[model samples]
Target: MTVAQLSPQSQVAALPQTWDLERRHQSMRRLVDVVQQLSLARSLEAIMDIVRVAARELTGADGATFVLRDRDQCYYAEEYAIQPLWKGQRFPLTACVSGWAMMSRQAAVIPDVFDDPRVPADAYRPTFVKSMAMVPIRTEAPIGAIGTYWAVHHEPGQDELTLLQALANTTSVAMENVRVWSELEDRVDQRTRELDAANRELESFSYSISHDLRAPLRAIQGFCQIYLEDHGDTVPVEGRPILETVVSNTERMSALIEDLLRFSKLSRQPLERHTVSLDDLVRRIVSAQRAAAEPGREIDVAVGPLGQCEGDSSLLEQVLVNLISNAFKFTRGRTPARIEIGRRSDGDEPVWFVRDNGAGFDMRYAGRLFGVFQRLHSAEAFEGTGVGLSIVQRIVQRHGGQIRAESAPGEGATFSFTLGQGS
Candidate 1:
């Protein structure tokens, strides 16, 4: 880009033919300082100081003043203070040379304020102020003006005009930065508010699950128990199966309620990762199942040595208990049923699995396996609330891990899960 293509306000001033080259070079150095200050400083106030100091030193004027346009045209705002001259002075929008440049949208350079027809008479009565130079801050319409006033009558040379215009151009860009920064801060604050609202909606959903689920479950359990106690003897033998059905439905409902509560509690609770012995939790659950089996039924249990993992001991125990219980129920009809609990570490955190030789599931229905209340078998063929693997999925996800299922009809079922690993 050529210097001629620069902003009109940045053009070199029309200088007198007799001006010396040394004075002009000094003016160029001061203009360099103005551009560097605008680029380096962070805040608006520091930038205004750079402009004030640069403008005064470059021209050797008695006093320089800079003003900016405000939201309302009632006042052209004071932008900077340079002392010991016009540090606290202000020029009104309607009655000063500064006002003329802003209103006309042009640079008004007055070599002698007293002889200039454009100068306001009322703006100079009380002081010895004589000659002055005023220039409009152009480029995207003049927002304000910059000028210097001398105490004695004198004319401003071309080099002095050139220096003042350069200072004015730099001030325009610095002002624009302040405006953009204000807009960015406002946008950030708006996004913060939106995130806060979404979190509150999630909290409300959790509350509904806690209070709404438990009420209906209590009613189903109470009425089923009442029917078995009060009407079992009087009911006909054919109606006995109806009472059994009610009892089964209530049991499934109770299990569903418990699963919902556990899912809601996982995130808010602190994790207690300990080196756990899965075999011990497995043994306890199996022993209880063996004691609860029906007449003449036997399910053999085989458990391998489980490698350790970092997880809450109580929670991991529950995961094993659910998977094993599902295995036992699904394979009860087999003549010689078998259940195995085993693990493989393989350079990662241990992954344990439960395999059962019983009625296996179709692979096409695999995606529905871990969803709550999803069942592949009927109540008569195998009894379950269908929440076992769903609980396993939640526990695994809490530990930053995953769970999977593999099975086909009549072959058997295997449920496995891993925790805390990428290997």
Candidate 2:
């Protein structure tokens, strides 16, 4: 009110300065909004367009252009203006202000385009641009520049220069984000393609093993049986033992192929999840193993309360079979084999375990435990194809779970697994 009481000339003189400050504040607010929107730009072209338009509007420029550094050339890739400007044009770095800003790594503010020796006179003679400012997109290792033009001879204020630099900085970050996102997408696509090709090859191999390979094996087994039945008396005693050995080896090979097929199928099979009573499943597996065990061998197996878990029933059954069978197999020399199956709550997930007083392995070889055909014991000590644990690991992974073994040599082995969720 006291200022208003003064002369009208005083108030009028102050109005232009006040309006200039308000305009700059408004531009700063708009720049903030532009930067936020630019962050979400997914492509380079979109980012360029956003930067060009924001630069023109925020600085009250007659036109705006985004010039990208392409090798030794400055490419005018995009433009936003009331009149036609250099859009889709390329020039040498020596002849363009945008290029000059990028080369110097600083902002270029020219009040008179013709008076500046850096300005290319012939190139600007036909344009409405009498003054312009160019700012490097990035201060360190500048990638490009943002250029703004005016129709009349004008000097860019500090506020205008600052706002343009801010826009240029934001544009650099947006461009970088777009590049990183594109690279990530490409990598993901490449990996997906590789996985698809690998799966196809595995299917072909599985087919060969099931049909082509099995045919020859069956033929050998059949011919051996024919010789035993038809020419048993004609064959010599030593020759008969050799033929029996051949038959036994063929049977073992058949078992190996079957297990191989199962292991391969796990990679392709989709999971079917349901709540399964592990208590009942473990009991059935233990009963079967006991039946197949050596006659008169008493194995004390304690079945504890095994809580329910959500997983593929058939796959989980296979996991229990492999683990429990290993327990029984390794406990061969013990007078009374001790095996315990139980469950406990660990946080939100249920941890189920199978413990057995068996011939445990050294912890040093644990890294190779889940590999295909990696066995801790020799064939003479424990007979297996060494594919069981690998299959178990794959199944557990498919069910969004984990399986790990704890054991030391000459002590005992305990396998603990958690079924987090069904995949």
Candidate 3:
């Protein structure tokens, strides 16, 4: 006889009713409510609860279960209204009809579960599900199976199978959305920690730079002064020049220390931006540099009618000083050399350029030009701490600006950099 020919009552003395249309309608209504609730739920636990409740009612099966297929095993992921079909249980993929549904990626309605050789008799006997509808709950792949079952034999017709499949579809989509949300949260948390670590490393680097650079400068200055004071008269003429060299080296070191401190402080402080004239700032910087220059050196300062910019005056002054000093120092060899400090409008804002017929840098070394302790010329050729351009670069960067240099071995350099456009 076919599986259906065997009466459900005859096959199992304790079989459930299969053709109760009124009972089936009530079960399906409860299922529709469950699917709607699952759709609105955000939490995984809530979604699973809806799935289980719907499964229990729709199948009219005494027990229902949700299984999570992990690797090759199907474990009781969650349970529902009925005495569970082996509640909190697990079964191997090679052993049961539910596992077969998971592996095959399809639904199975077994009118007689044990009648099919695929069903594990021992696993089924515990919470007798003689009639069964197993639906795979899937998102990316086969994740698990949701099954509605009977405690005794009852043929689950097509209507019950359809309801079971619908519930599984709802669970699959909801689970996938929740999994994606969890992964995104993890990625954001990891990125935040990485950024915090980077900031701490930068702070440690700054502290080390300060301690290592200034400690030796103090000793060089102290020893140079002591030698000149104690043994000035007895020292030979050749020795005196060497002593003078010591004093010069110490002074240069002191200047370098001051420049480095200034650069470091700039990075930590907040900018005090206000409206100021670019043209006026340049003129003042030029005058001060000329006064500090060897008594007779000329520098021509030319710029268009002043344009107003919003920025920190003190930092801007330092930027102008560094750029102008570099211009003056480089052009020292030319008998009547000229240094021009100028500014012009680029689109809506002013762009500044310092052009000089003085020492120019090689283009290949341009990459290192704006790094602290990065020097293009040797101390023998030009006297500087090499930290000035670095300061200039930082100040420009903090102001959301950009800088560039154009120079060749013999050709004079032109440093062009732009600040934000003035309103």
Task: Name the candidate that leads on TM-score.
Answer: 2
The lowest-lDDT stretch of 10 consecutive residues in candidate 1 is 74-83
Identify the runs in model 2 with alpha carbons over 4 angstroms from their true place: 1-65, 69-106, 110-132, 139-142, 147-155, 173-199, 206-210, 233-235, 273-280, 303-310, 345-349, 419-423
- Write one digit per residue (lDDT tens) for candidate 1, span 1-423: 544675765544423222456678778977886788887766667766776667667877767666665532424333322334333455565666777777876667776676777776555655556777777666457777677767777678788877887778777777777667767877888887886577456645755775687787677778867877898798789887877777777677666667666665665667788788676778888998888778788778898987567788888887887888888888888877899999876464667789999899999999999897788999778877677777788888888888888999998999878886631
Superposed Cα deviation of residue 30, candidate 3 (Å): 30
Best of the two (2, 3) by lDDT: 2
lDDT of 3 at 91: 75
Per-model C-alpha lDDT, please?
0.73, 0.89, 0.78
Q: Which digits, one per residue and each the tens of the lDDT, describe model 2 over residues 1-423?
A: 554675899888877877887897899889999999999999998998789889989889999999999999999999988788889999999888988899999999999999998999888998899999999999998889999999999889898999999999999999999999999999999999999899879866875766677778988988998999999999998899999988988887787787888888887788888889888899899999999999988799998999677888999999999999999999988878999989887776778899988999999999999997899999879888888999999998888789999999878899998876542
Off by over 4 Å in 1: 1-224, 227-233, 236-244, 347-349
User: Model 3 off-target regions past 4 Å?
Assistant: 1-139, 142-216, 345-350, 420-423
Candidate 3: deviation at residue 9, Å?
56
Top-lDDT structure, candidate number: 2
TM-score of each: 0.51, 0.72, 0.56
Error of 1 at 106 (Å): 27
